[model samples]
Target: MSIQTSRRALLAAAALAAPAIWGRDAVAQIRRGDELTVGIWGGAQERITRQFCATPLERQHGVKINYVLGGTPERRARAYAERGRPSFDLLYLNIFESRQAVKDGVTMASSANVPNFANLYDIAKIGGYAVAFNPVTIVYDRRKVAAPMTSWRDFWRDDLKGKVIWPTYPGAQGTSALLMAAKVWGGSESNIDPAFTNIARLRPFAAIQGSQDQLYGMFDQDVGAASVEFGSFTRKYAETRNPNIVIADPTEGQAIATNVACITTGTRNQALAEAFVNLHLSPECQAAYAEEIYYSPTIKNVSFAPELAAKLILGEAAVNKLVDFNWDLVIANQPRWSSRFTREIAG
Candidate 1:
């Protein structure tokens, strides 16, 4: 059977077997024909979300969920623009964006309504309901680089000259890498000059990649030796496309790209929105996400097999080791950094 058919079958079986999984309170609050609009990402992410959360919620409660699909920038822009009278009931944002959203009063803060909010790990509490933790690490071609990467400084190695692909500015990979570059050279978020100065050393890049697919293509062609990338993308690509790819947790540490879901500040359907967020945080949905895309769960309730657990950032110890940044400071400096990156580095 096709993937869509299988998903439908699974939903049917789930509804039949345990409709209570959605919770009685949510079922009672949601009336037939109730509509909820959400801003979310598209493609496989959308498909899996529908299968595990949206479709199941619809079936269980007889509600209609209308999705506004695109990248985070558009959704974030809309959230801010429509703050006074927001159209979307919920939106998915990255960690920094979500924190900014809350600070700007465009998104609602955690409340008793979102009971599952209490189930998440402390690191996932970034002003919104965090869904997954994506580690930004060094990804290299194993066959090309015989020396395993153990630190962020490895990017500047002479052996990998002219083969490194840097992430373009205005992206998670780019921002994380820039900060990492700063930290490795004695500068930091508070003093970011070193990143621009240091990053210039790795000039003559193969490409300034903007998307995982672009980077993956370069890796497949043997054009890229190493680069800063998300663990989810690298691990996913390595497992599905190329075993030669390998991820390294730098000696300096790993940077996390936490993805979040939030209730719009002026949403008319607060109850429904909270219910949807709760379902998305459910162990079943979180587990499905980990299995499909390799995004580590935000909740402590979910468990994975040993192999999968090793690949994910699970438990308090692993969570605490991640290098934390002053995101407010980072976001405030983004515009200036973006310009410098273009002129000095990628230019």
Candidate 2:
């Protein structure tokens, strides 16, 4: 069956099974007087927390959740500098930063107590780290082009010169865009020079800096024909009367980005924090959050809403085709890469 079909089947099964799934475990773990603090990015992250995490966690566990909002890199640095006296107990960070944070000792090793750690998809539990969310496929404005655009190579087409708006240098997604360029030009984990050369070739077309909101605005105003942006952000944009916009999974393979959750070393509430992670990975929680926020579900058994399922790039087969990277290398090499990128492209 197609991914869409399987997703629908899964969602149907989850909806039918949710009440039974939450029956005893949730109540046993959470108490009425207990509270937990979670750190996440503002805007959409906050929205997801309110709509998905907070309400359900409160209802199921009788646990009150307090949210602290900031960019992951900044918040994580502060947490580590404070040396276990972090204001928030749980943190939500993008994959590369999450890996870096763990390496830096900002995050603690995950506890087995988180109920569904074993139930997570293999990729979600990289080593002992748990991915909290998945970004959707890249998107474009269909009205700006006629032919079907299929891969990252399409962005560099000579005919579409000076028409692409890209994220700023050093940004993870921006860097991913560069990696996509490398992949298209035959660069792999062992080689990246050709990709850098290819990017330099497209320097004339690049928009070096812009906020997500600004990128969306450029698309709406026809300032740019396309951009590589998160699926959820594009979907939200499409909902705001930009019916001409559409998402396309590149023929080569879809790229998937993750946000992760980990344990902290000095937590006084280790058990509670672990429980929260467990709840986050539960099928009920995954389905609820996926349906509400339009992100792909990470828990294997949880199902995405039909619309979201259709939009997600990392379906079963697609997941296998995803390119894996050494995030530590990427983080370490970021400065050098950014410098070269600025000198050649942004300068």
Candidate 3:
């Protein structure tokens, strides 16, 4: 083997060995019925996590998973508030939030703790252990629009004037959509003036596609096109909810929004938390998440049937093609962007 490959092998071996060496002691900590709290989202996320990560860890370790299920904001707040004495052993955040958490020292370096970090795609390792990625792209009603939309520019078509619904301001989808708008125009992330200007021009939106339910329900109204929505939702909605819905592969590229898993700083059950994260990133859990929710796996080894693969954003090549936001800029300018969006676009 090459020197680098040999070194990587040694590191992986050591990572695997560390848990095993201390697991006997860790098992005692857990087998005493200690609760390892996991702050996660509700709905499909909660269901899949329970089935794949929590139940398996609980069964194997004889510990209970105290699930704190809610939105990311609440979970993030808890992580920040309880920094030195964190209640959440494992906290789930979006890529942006995860970065901020790491910077603020609210979260531990996931690579140091998560052994499966070695097996994931390099892109997925950016913020933390990004378990799944939901591509943000354009979704349109096939029946309402005469032609299939191919680019982000289609969102601004005269025909789609009153039919297109923008995601609410400060939301991930909306933030991503703004970046896309700026890019396709003559601007970039640092120069976001064009995005706001163009968004204002596309006035009298049909409705705000805020939540997942709202995104699905908007199609029944005058909504012919979504400025930006999750591709997984669009694909699933097309199959299960609305046959007329179609996801547009924009020429500019799709934004990658991810569900990142992080170990909170000062986690009491560090070993168990690492073990849970390891299992969460395991092939079985990753596959289940991809198959169940249509979110693409972050790990490189997980595979899907051809039919299912067609619906997902798979492989390293495809992952590289995704439009990555300047999250540092996005997060920093959020307040100003939100104010501008409210006064210009939403007003």
The order by descending lDDT is 1, 3, 2
Candidate 2 — what's its lDDT?
0.65
Query: Clashing pairs in model 3?
Result: none
lDDT of 1 by residue, 36-127 (tens): 99899887668767876677778877888999999899999988888869999899999888988999999977765666778888878777
The per-prediction tally of clashing pairs is 0, 1, 0
lDDT of 3: 0.78
Candidate 3 lDDT, tens digit per residue, 1-347?
11122334433433343232233564434444667888898888888667666766666557788888899999998889998799898889998899888888898766744677888888788656888989888988877776889888888887787888889878888888898899988898899999999887788888777876787877766454665788887787788878878888777779888889888888778777777777778766666666767888888777777777888888888899898877888889999999988888887
Error of 3 at 23 (Å): 8.3
In angstroms, the error of model 3 at 131 is 0.3
Listed in order, each prediction's TM-score against the native is 0.91, 0.83, 0.90
CA lDDT, every model vs. true structure? 0.82, 0.65, 0.78
lDDT of 2 by residue, 276-314 (tens): 566566565555555555566666665554656775544
lDDT score for residue 99 of model 2: 67
lDDT of 2 at 271: 53
Name the runs in model 3 displaced over 4 angstroms. 1-32
Candidate 1 displacement at residue 160 in angstroms: 1.8
